[model samples]
Target: MIKRLVLLAVFVGGILFTSSSQNIVMDKSNVEFRVANLGANTVKGKFTGMTGNVTFDPKNIAKASFDVCIDATSINTRMKKRDTALKGPKYFDIARYPEICFASKTVSRTGMNYKVIGSLSMHGVKKEVEIIFNSSRNTLTGKLKVNRLDYKIGPKSGVFVGKQVDITITCVVE
Candidate 1:
């Protein structure tokens, strides 16, 4: 009886250990981004077509990983003319770069939050950026803003209508 009980405990413990290391499947529907442009006025928008995978271990950040890709052509600014111009070659150039991507290289724990460093690719240019996110075993979400001029998306203007752009992302994993 003693031996049987010991064996049962060992088997249950093994199951738990293996389950934690298994690849976590994050639901794609839980992911989204909000864009806000704060300049002469506050212009807010949102984007769909968010697709990504996240394999994370709360105990060990080195083992944590995430990859997200956004469809550039799905950008919506609520203005038909501005949206058309945004997809032009001078801006996002959807013909040449149809996707905006992010792949994390490192993650640092900060209490209940985490700082993720990754490469953000847009307009065929990749740049390293750090974003802070609230991470838990069940969910991870964050926000970031990128300027159009930083990636050379649009031409310079004396009186800029919009300059800063904000992005927010949220996700859930099971």
Candidate 2:
């Protein structure tokens, strides 16, 4: 009889742990990027709109998953001309692909943080990527580097624009 009680308690505890996952708070989240332009000059920008759902439970890391989308048309660099060019065919082509998305397939612990293996889709191209992030309470912060040419984001001869882009993301889960 004592063994049965202990087994029941453990099963209930497992359920409670998994149910602790939360949804992401979009208004409090941010996604931004940095890249180099001509003359080794740097340009920084951000996407103004984002929506996503997050299921995160540190104790149950295997069940955690993230499916997020950012508005491609919301790219802003504080410069009207540059923003316009970024939405054109040579860059994001927002008219054709209006959203950039990431959906996680697996989540695993890495040291004190976590690593998520996921599929990132942008500009009509999809690629597998790894995202490393740290979580504390309801907040998460992470960064990843990607090459623009891998997604056909820019011209093959990117002499004026750098091929590598660094991206950062921060969010609060409710």
Candidate 3:
């Protein structure tokens, strides 16, 4: 009887562990960004479509991983004309690159949060970036800075737009 109870307990523990690291829930998540326009005014926007898988275990940071993608065509800035122009060749060029993606290469715990080192592919360019984030039971919040020129998303000249873009990501996983 004692042996059987121990086996059952072990099995239940294994099931719980596996389930926690498999699927990530993104139903309440958001990906947003901010950049300065030609007149030095801040322009804020968000991508409505996002999908991702995360295998995160706070206890086993070494095995954690993340793969996420955002729809480039879903950019919304509350300005019809500006939004249209962003989808054109001078900006996102959604026709040629419909998705912006990121895949983690490594994950390490920082002071109180964590850092994800990964590859960010956008506008036909792939570059390594570090994202710092904090996670709760099933939610993760993070931010990173990206240079628009690095991804070739816009012209090299900063006359019309700032070179640096600030991005924030909030994701929840089941």
Candidate 4:
């Protein structure tokens, strides 16, 4: 029993020493999002407000953790009328759900990026999704494209705007 206990303690200590944790560092100047109206050459709008954190251990991705949030009201399509409409119940419903969030449950390293399995909550609904992201000391960027309809997001179009929306987030790892 003593030998086993000692071995286990050493193993746990080694893991803690090998892994590193990081925090989310937004550039504040480099955050944006674009939404389209489909088939139209014109892209609808963009969003501004953003904040989050990312913890990682490249050598040990299993030790990684992440949480991100975006301000729903910050959405801007260059038109106040359209932006306001987006915040309504038909779309984001900002009053009922002011923030879109993600919390990672597991992290696995694959190729050049890490695959994160997490719960994404938006408009008062939560779903599991995977986010592929690359993390380095200089910068960490994550790009995940998910359909609004998957989260029961409003009456975009029965035609299906590709059934997937592209989302990309870039931030510094602190």
Give the poorly placed runs of model 2, Cα more than 4 Å off: 1-21
Candidate 3 residues lying further than 4 Å off, grouped into runs, are: 1-24
The residue pairs found clashing in candidate 4 are: 45-77
lDDT of each: 0.70, 0.87, 0.87, 0.71
Model 2 per-residue lDDT tens digits across residues 35-106: 888847989999856787788888888778998888899999999999999999999999999999999999
| C-alpha lDDT of candidate 2 relative to the true structure | 0.87
Q: What would the per-residue lDDT of candidate 1 be over residues 1-174, giving only the tens digit for each residue?
A: 999999999998865653453333433423243333434466555455667767666666777777877778887778999888879998889999998888999988988788889999999888888888886556678877777677777665524435556667766555
Candidate 2 differs from the real structure by a C-alpha RMSD in angstroms, to one decimal, of: 4.7
Per-residue alpha-carbon lDDT of candidate 3 for residues 5-124, written as tens digits (9 for 90 to 100): 999999988657644555545457778999998866999999866787788877778788889988899899999999999999999999999999989999999999999999999999
- Candidate number with the higher TM-score (2 or 3): 3
Candidates, ranked, TM-score: 3, 2, 4, 1
**Candidate maximizing TM-score:** 3
lDDT of residue 130 for candidate 2 = 94
Off by over 4 Å in 4: 1-21, 27-35, 42-48, 160-162
RMSD list, candidates in order: 4.5, 4.7, 3.0, 7.0
TM-scores, one per candidate: 0.74, 0.86, 0.87, 0.75
Better of 1 and 4 by TM-score: 4
